[model samples]
Target: MSQWFQYDRRIFKYFNYLLVIQIIPLLAISSYLINEINPLLFKKQMLYYGIGAIAFLVTTFIPWRKLIWWFAPLFYTMNLLLLLAVDLVGKTILGAQRWIEIPGTGLTMQPSEFVKVSVIMMLAYLISKKPPLEQGYGLVGFIKLSLVILIPFLLIAKEPDLGTALVLLITGYGILFVIGINWKIWLVLAVAVGLSAPVLFSHLHDYQKKRITDFLGQPSYPVHQALIAIGSGGVEGKDKDEATQTQLKFLPISSIDFIFAYLGERLGFHGMVTVIILYILLILHLFYIAIRN
Candidate 1:
């Protein structure tokens, strides 16, 4: 018992506890929403949460700074190869081939997600070696970094997982913004992207185009129902049966995509504001830590 007490795995040193805490509201809200949808799913989500906690603990055990430089390149190379393999042999669901089945696990995984992690790691490794100049990265430096970002962005977008691709692109650029990019370079890129918008729109996949069309043409049935759910809540929420949008199941995927709407319908305007405040606090805490360190 004494030995166990003396042995510190340094759990507290591993991750930002406040960051972990910040996620609790989202987890609680998700679990509650799933419970409302089906009690079994809530239980499954709890089990997944437990598994995720174990995964997080395991990840913290890694000697990230020491091995990340060596591994990031290898990991990124493999990520790109897997993405290429997906293009040829990936399993298609809906209309996109973005997943590969794990051999014998009967489980599927998206390679695009792996690309995102590897890119972040790889960028950190790259940038730390050659920190940005005072004015920011020059022309040559900018292209090198852009290549690192754009390769995976284009590959993932080709998988037609445009949403995830865009997210990864934004995250990479957001990091650049923090690290500092030449103001002139940013301006030039912005103008180029703006000019290319029409051409890019023309190249979008049919379903992707249809999604945009649907957004412009008519509100989706789900969106319309979600609006009703939000509008009905007013200042204070109604009783369970009186929450017709959720209770009558008019608000589709209330537990997932339209969860904000479900939250409003069940808890009212105040609850929504409270959740928003918590998220804002979390963001401020992250910014505080960033600045302090």
Candidate 2:
């Protein structure tokens, strides 16, 4: 245990540093914008951020491999249960049944996020356990790994979290490739994916289909609103009052997924560039550790 701690000290240090460098500036910018628009919302965002940071730090300090291996099945099961629970009793927000409210705690949980990390960890473990590609067992191992990944992929896709489910599929395929899945199999899957796109599109909900169609410039208010936000940001963006109003009124999803757009509007080109560089550095550092391990 002590040796594990000693070995991970450097990793923990870098993780904290990366968190501070990447998150603090983003939070500061977000808080500033939020404060300008709505002080109460800004305070709530900060409190949520603080709680999330503490949870993140705790997870980082623990040995991920041990946690994954020890609790992978339990974690996976719990998340599945939560996802089911959400379907039965979850709060509806923005037309998605992706969040569940916990009574007494007054907190909403997003089970899909937990599922993402669980899937990644499980994949990592399975890949680590497998023999080299030269071994005769590689094909069988690959099939088993595919099953492990596909189950959650289908479940989350059912939740209709297209973006995250796609991310999971990509990351799973990436891990399999890293563990030496044959290129021929990848080619087959690529062809299958290509063939299935039309069918997949047909299966999507009306709004989901519209989002894709709108991306292709089919008529849609959502698309127009998004374009307006982008256009308003301009090459250098609007002045402070304009930026604040744009956020408060115009920019939908200003706090979460579209936070980058908000950052671009207020901080302009230089700030966006800085944020990208910081992310690149942090990702490189994480990759370095993964490779070293």
Candidate 3:
């Protein structure tokens, strides 16, 4: 008990307070909205949040360097297997097969989220151990990292989660940058991405492409409704009951991806700004911790 208390004290003393601050607001807003919608769902979500928080806190005390080295390959392989399993027996939701149901628990495992974290850890470990940045670590390291990244990237894209795939790419590139990879390589990659944009656009699933097009002002039911919600907010929001009714009636994804929209309708522009500020601060805090460590 003494050792555990010491451990907690050391970790929390240096814990990212800004991140905690940001997360609290997000949780508060999400919980409030969820509770207003369905008390049972809010309770279930809180339970899940608690379990995740406990797991994270417990893992924090384990030396990150040791953990990263020991679990990198294991995590990478496990995510690969999970992705394969997802392909075989995953539950499909809203046209995406990205979750696997755990028998008896009634809980679904989203391997893609796990894949992101694992990929980040693995790359950070590998790159940290790479040859001097000035020496150009040869094609071998680049190839290995590319393969590691592509496996999950392709799998998640197959799950039809473009947002997640993009995030993986960004995280991989961010790790590479942190490891002092040359700017010229990044420049070339950026150019390649630009060059491939048209081909990528052509390959996107119709609805996937349509969502981007809709966001850019193409006529679509989802975009139309989202705009209405935003516009209706009008600097200040309607009452909670009215907001819930409006959201349930119009907003397609009032609970998930479009939760921001729901919040905007219910809490108005100031609320949206607060949420965005929290996200920004949280990201900055994580970056600070990553750099310091």
Top lDDT hit: 1
Q: Is candidate 2 or candidate 3 better by TM-score?
A: 3
Candidate 2 matches the true fold with a TM-score of: 0.79
What is the per-residue lDDT of model 2 for residues 222-255, given as tens digits with 9 covering 90 to 100? 4455556655676776666777535466666665
Put down candidate 1 lDDT per residue, 207-273, tens digits, no spaces.
7897798799987778889888988998787766788998888997777678889888988898789
Q: Which of the two, 2 or 3, has more lDDT?
A: 3
lDDT of 3 by residue, 41-92 (tens): 7887988899999998777666655456778889889999999998999999
CA deviation > 4 Å runs, candidate 2? 1-19, 34-45, 56-68, 135-139, 218-220, 233-240, 244-248, 283-293
Model-by-model lDDT, in order?
0.85, 0.71, 0.79
Off by over 4 Å in 3: 1-9, 38-40, 60-64, 244-248, 283-293
Candidate 3 lowest-lDDT run of ten? 1-10
**Candidate 2 or 1, higher lDDT:** 1
Model 1: how far residue 185 lies from native, Å: 1.9
Residue 198's C-alpha lDDT in candidate 3?
A: 98
